[model samples]
Target: MTVLSYADSALSLLPPVVAILLAIFTRRVLLSLGLGILIGALLLNQWSVLDTGVYLGQRVLSLVWDDGAFNAWNLYILGFLVLLGMITALITVSGSARAFANWARQHIRNRRDAKLLTMFLGCAVFIDDYFNSLVVGSIARPLTDRYYISRSKLAYLLDSTAAPVCVISPVSSWGAYIIALIGGILTAHGFTETGHLSAFVQMIPMNFYALFALALLLCVAYMELDIGAMRKHELNARKGNLYDETKGLPPGANADLPEAETGQVHGLFLPIGVLVVATFYFMVSSGADALAAESLPFTIIGAFEKTDVGSSLFFGASIGLVVTLLLAFIQKIEAKMILKALTSGARSMLPAIYILMFAWTIAGIIGSLETGKFMASLASGNIPFALLPAVLFILAGLTAFSTGTSWGTFGIMLPIAADMAMGSHSSMMLPMLAAVLSGAVFGDHCSPISDTTILSSTGAGCHHIDHVLTQLPYAVLVAVISLGGYIVLGFTESVWLGLASSCVLFLLGLVWLKWQQPKNTNA
Candidate 1:
């Protein structure tokens, strides 16, 4: 599909809004995404029905085949998802999950401990959001389930920590990508006061949303905080309902698998350990190969910057699946049962795979529509210097929300932000850029179409809409507080002062929530 002449106009916002609203109200993800893509096609084709149909069909087909070639990245990611599902199912059939749950029960004394442990695991797996979401959720689900912790709550913990932690850690995939983007932006704008890595470190304090989101997760866990639809989910979970049965089994769920009584804890630990180590090694190794091809030195950061994450994840998951199969064989599980687990596991991931395809297609249409260009345009022309950071945060959030991608938003908005700052608010460049990062994460954190959000729900075996509805309030509250912090940073030109104010505000917000809860209720 070609870019429409009015691509940068307000008209570009209509499809995403229509899709998001439909998804929220009807809880039908694929239907909503399909309609959105159709609507976008209509707009691009000037409302010609046949043209719209053709364009929409082409875009959907382009997911697997584009420009006379296969789309390797998308296919690789799909392969990884399938392999991850098989591995998870095998673990359950082998009773590794139950065995680990039994082992964890000895160490985790109560529900609070379970929740806290989940948060800690989420934070620990910060190398990649996709890896973190699945691994942490798989490791923590059994323990959380043992304590009757809600799957929605577990999903919230996973979703909140993945991007927020990754966005801040310099060694993370998100960090390396953003650092490379920053390097280019800095070079283009002739800013040499700091290198890309140092600039990222400096901006960490100013990234109010990421910091506040992490803090909010800690407070929610320790304080047993339950906001919005989450409260109902928690109430249900306490009664042994981990998720809404009316909605059917969620993605990654395999309730029919029987537990093997003889399973050992190592059955779970060794596979996950292998997955992490293999994935990390592949990421670095593949990154190094890319560097070698370019005649560049092999530094960890440089390797990460050029690494093909999709293929790396695919390779890692494949190796992990082999290990999982070996463990099952060692335990003397029936071959028939092992084969069943593989088929069933792949089947379970079908919904997520479908939703992901729709999401990517719509995101592609959104790109052609120039949604981010229109969004970034909103921040130009006449903004006051003190309000620049706040405006950028809002714009970035809106852009990411509409496009369902933080990295795409970063690509669109970062250079615009650099230009805006260098053109006038020179001293506020770091804060403005930080606000974009903060907002992008904030938007991506809650958006229904976001891959991380979808994976978080899948990992926790919670309904996708349930995760989105439950997590939205918490994400919003943190964003509001972060917005206030950016406003302060903009005016004061002091990152510390802004950060301090956000911290105080976050605490106050927590206190208010505590006051609102009924004294006798557990949540």
Candidate 2:
């Protein structure tokens, strides 16, 4: 196998660093990412203006055509997204979603229930983060709006539950990706005896950030706790203002869909139920086939290990779209109206699809520059064994923050972290692995340019920057708690102790925030 090489100089960091800074300063994600790709191409081509321009164009074209639009994994994601959009459109056009919201109005009764329902839906759709964000947002938005919950709060709830839940769920797209990365690394390092699925299971307990985020989300929902910018948004929401007048609402808030005439809940439940059931069925069937192809016995975990997640998701989404259309027809929705809804729905996804493509392109550019390698190389020496996990966590977090991608961070850091652990304290392997995963998620959760973050904002009909600002404090709080846990685990090597301490710390933090709420309100 041939590995792409770079000069291993500090310049290797320029592309991502510049991209992150530009995004923060300008708040223009597409421009920032495009600039980052251009810079990487120029660096790779040694700054020849003509060659750099040519290389940049070729790279973009190749990424869109060869690696993204046509690639099997990319195609699956595109198909899934399009089909999901169609399903959402059908639901909206048929008035199923609005009807469900009407039904929920009678049952929800309070702000806490609305928020909790959003969180529950987010957690329930754990198969894919993209699916989770969009589906939960569409279903929960109307209910949240009825309760006067801030769009920022809705976005935060959707965002928090998305990647965090997927990272921990063993049957998710995230799990499949992590398994493949770990499996390849273990095989390369002659540690194949410890199966990838088993190793991933071991890391779950140590995934402090994901666990803490979920716990904190539930606490926030149940307590109706509002702090920082989120507090202001919540206060405004109570006055019938869903968003800040200055920031304005997302364009998605103005989608052109028909109103609910029937106000029946079955329109919502039956289609979503089909989507959930069909997704799992396809995942299991695809995984089973893969396992059989390898002449291996079919077990649930083993099947997931072999599953093609993107393809399964695509198939599942397709089935969901079909089922939703059938339901729409039964509801007396005309064929012409259904066609219009499908077109409108797919069209609505264009912004998110473009963002996803740019994110992928930037990641590819950074990968070619070997940026992760340069960052990981710093961990090889000078860092003490006892502090390695904590240090690695910080490094991984910074790298993911700069790149705005958790999966890309995993691709870069997992192999390096695994190798380092194999050569040192074998017992530290789980903590280190968990550190990388947690750190990546923490960064991705916070980054304004992250795809999931964008999707979350879009789903909740919140301003993208508003979502980032309102959610940052909570993400940082969890990250701090997770970092402390990793440091303790590094020293004590006790997963239970580390987890216990982290939970206590998180609870204390919440209490302190609550105590300071009066001052915050006064301010």
Candidate 3:
């Protein structure tokens, strides 16, 4: 009856690897995730039988929307998906799929463009992390598939882009988390000097860990130099070989429609343009000035005043899809045709939407676990000053991975790392804190339990665990190289070396993969 108790949360939630396995094996993400949340709440609440069911939904929703934030702004994230569905629907109704196939029929050149386009989009949406990941993944997945990119590759691109961009952006969720965490740490370190917020402002330019990760992501995308799962998949794709198909995408996701008809796919770009422009305008003009990672609640409220809450930011994008369908209507498209297009788009996202709610629910449960206290305690003590950054990185990674929420991890670890910086002899307090946040994201970006990871896999229509197993090897490699860089960083005291080391390791991996491909092909 009890999933876990307050006294047992440490044991009950440890790793969550089993939870992931069940979700994948049953092909039941929503059920598995919902049960996980229910168990989590029951663990904390210690409720009796009937009361558990009664409190389940109530607790989850309350936790997700306690300050009315989720109700007010979660729409921004989902809105793009809805819009994507709309564009796909309209493309279908306009016979654009046929047109697209026809266009591709004549234009066959390079697969490299797909990888480049994905990286370009990832960098473009640097201001908003969630919007970046979801929109980029949705937009690029189909395009990447055309070039024979694997779903794992697609998820990797999506995952890689999200946190790396967020870490660099002075305005997104990452910004806010660092400010909050660092400010707290500054207080503990007796550096009322600049406050923790100022520490983040100071920290950004010095965060070599995140800077290096972003660099690695771009290098891999640009050079087509694959390593880890990416290198393996590239070799297979090049030889017309396949990955583990049982856990991979269906043929329809990659192939052209069977029995093609004729028309144009003109509206594919409009709604996305609307979403992009609107997000920038709202982010800039809504007067949120989220650059300071200022008040999240106020920012969301301000956005609603014009952006219509988070939903409004993407409203234009969604309507843009409808407008595309309307173009079809104005050109003599039947009402049924438009509605069917819209309907198809909505249906396509049903699975993702359902799973997202469960993901949100689990996140709520983890947040309730009071991660801030746990991480803060861990950061206290006589650890070596030089090893502080690496330790913070690993701890932040663990907290984020276990909690399934990087924001929560940031809330808990950033301040702690900042405090460690204060207590230590190092003058690079800001850099140390940056390492903490970046490390949290390293694990969060790849963890099976992480909501972002789930969302990315969902966006690509890939099996989530498949994304995890394949992506882990690469994420771990980057972490290890970065860790080595951090170790030498203590003596060199140079951010450049850390960045250079990450780049070098990535290139080395690329070369190794290329050399091994002949063997892989021969075998």
Candidate 3 deviant stretches above 4 angstroms: 1-9, 15-17, 21-28, 61-70, 97-108, 171-173, 176-209, 222-266, 288-309, 500-504, 519-523
Give all TM-scores, in the order shown.
0.98, 0.90, 0.81
Candidate order (lDDT): 1, 2, 3
Full-model lDDT for every candidate = 0.89, 0.81, 0.62
Inter-residue clash pairs, candidate 1: none
Please identify model 2 stretches exceeding 4 Å from their true place. Answer: 1-7, 67-69, 180-198, 241-256, 334-336, 519-523
Is candidate 2 or 3 superior in TM-score? 2
RMSD of each: 1.2, 3.3, 5.0
The segments of candidate 1 whose C-alpha lies over 4 angstroms from its true place after superposition are: 1-5
lDDT of prediction 2: 0.81
**For model 3, what is the alpha-carbon lDDT of residue 257?**
23
Instruction: Assess candidate 1 and give its lDDT.
Output: 0.89
Error of 2 at 17 (Å): 2.3
Q: For candidate 1, lDDT tens digit of each residue in 1-523?
A: 4447555589999889988999999999999999998888888888988888888788878889989999989999899989989998899889888988988889888888899889999999888999999888888888899989999999999998899999999888999999999988887887777898999898988899998999889988888888678989999999999999998999888878877787888888888889999999999999999999999998888888988889888999999999999999999999988998999999999989998898998888888889889999999879898899999999999999999999999999999989889988687888889999999999998788888898999889899999999999999999999998988888898988888889888989998878867677763
**Per-candidate count of clashing residue pairs (backbone under 3 Å):** 0, 0, 5
Which scores higher on lDDT, 1 or 3?
1
Residue 28 of model 3, lDDT score: 60
